[model samples]
Target: MTQKNNHTIARSWDEFSEQLLGFIISRIHHKEDAEDILQEVYLKSINNIDKLQEDSNLNAWLYTVTRNAINDYFRNKQKNKETITQDIFTEDTDALNIKDSFCCLEPHINELPGKYKEVILLSEIEGLKHQEIADKLKLSLSAIKSRVVRGREMLKEKFVTCCKYRIDENGKLAGEPDCQRPECNH
Candidate 1:
């Protein structure tokens, strides 16, 4: 690696190692396994650092790498097991349930104001990356990111107001959709 890349890696390690470790541990639970995943994230980031654009968000990029490393750890662990047990699959099950539950929010999403609806549909429903949405909509990257964030916030408000949904202690969606509006049927 070049001198600049070396410095970048060192700086990233100093800046993000602890935070990334906590992130991994939150997902992985076991200390040793979380440490292993954190090490893998560091190595992967080192190997792919060149691919990261100079203007890209480093913190976001590192978190994304760390998240992927955690996912891989779980996936490989599942692959090596002879049979999957309920305990081993709880997290994935919860994630799947969350995804399935969110499907019911489509009508609420459609009700969002025009601008928020457009970006939310593209990013959340259509699964477009923020940059891709920006490119497609002829908007600046920052604008697209801002719109996505704002749109999610609005959607959360709609969930609370219309569907009476609230995040539970574990941060999962807790409440059932009980639409308060006369026209709604969630």
Candidate 2:
């Protein structure tokens, strides 16, 4: 019975992936996110295949799962947005100064390892707070804070090593792009 169920699922994926992906892609702006949702829908459908009563209903069931996944994505996105208080949005000169120096940082950011990379992108690039970052990564608040601190330290090291940036009198990053490292792309 399990074998037959697996076979059915394989057939369904082969037949419906393109159609489902099209539906998902239309609803989702990003191609990668839409593909991820489709993969989630596929996993859920296969894992619970026995719960599906009939093969005739497979397409509808897949669509339902895809819809639920899309809803989950938006729900999480909305939750992340809600976590940032209005106060955090206001520009502090110190933060703005640091952000300004950190401009043209795409390559440095991409070089960060694993979830640390994601944390920096979310917290620094996207301006999510510690709690918001924690919510997004499903990590403890302290863990998120630690990762942010650690990630920043690593990034600072990279800047110093790669671009020769140093602290100014005001303690903000100060340097011209050295363009020494090929990856620095300065």
TM-score per candidate? 0.44, 0.51
lDDT of 1 by residue, 1-186 (tens): 677977987798899899999988887687987887888888998899898888998879999999888888777654332121121122333444333334446666788889889997777654578899999999999999898778766766666666566755543344455766655544
Instruction: Per model, state how many residue pairs clash.
Output: 0, 0
lDDT of 2 at 77: 53
Compared with the true structure, all predictions reach lDDT values of 0.70, 0.71
Q: Provide the RMSD of all predictions against the true structure, rounded to 1 decimal.
A: 16.3, 9.2
lDDT of 2: 0.71
The list of candidate 2 runs beyond 4 A from truth reads: 86-186
TM-score of 1: 0.44
lDDT against true structure, model 1: 0.70
Best model number under TM-score: 2
Query: Which tens-of-lDDT digit does each residue in 1-186 have in candidate 2?
Result: 499999988998999999999998998777987988888988898898899886468888888888999999777654443332121222322443334334435567689998788997788655678899888788999999898778766776666666676645543355554646554344
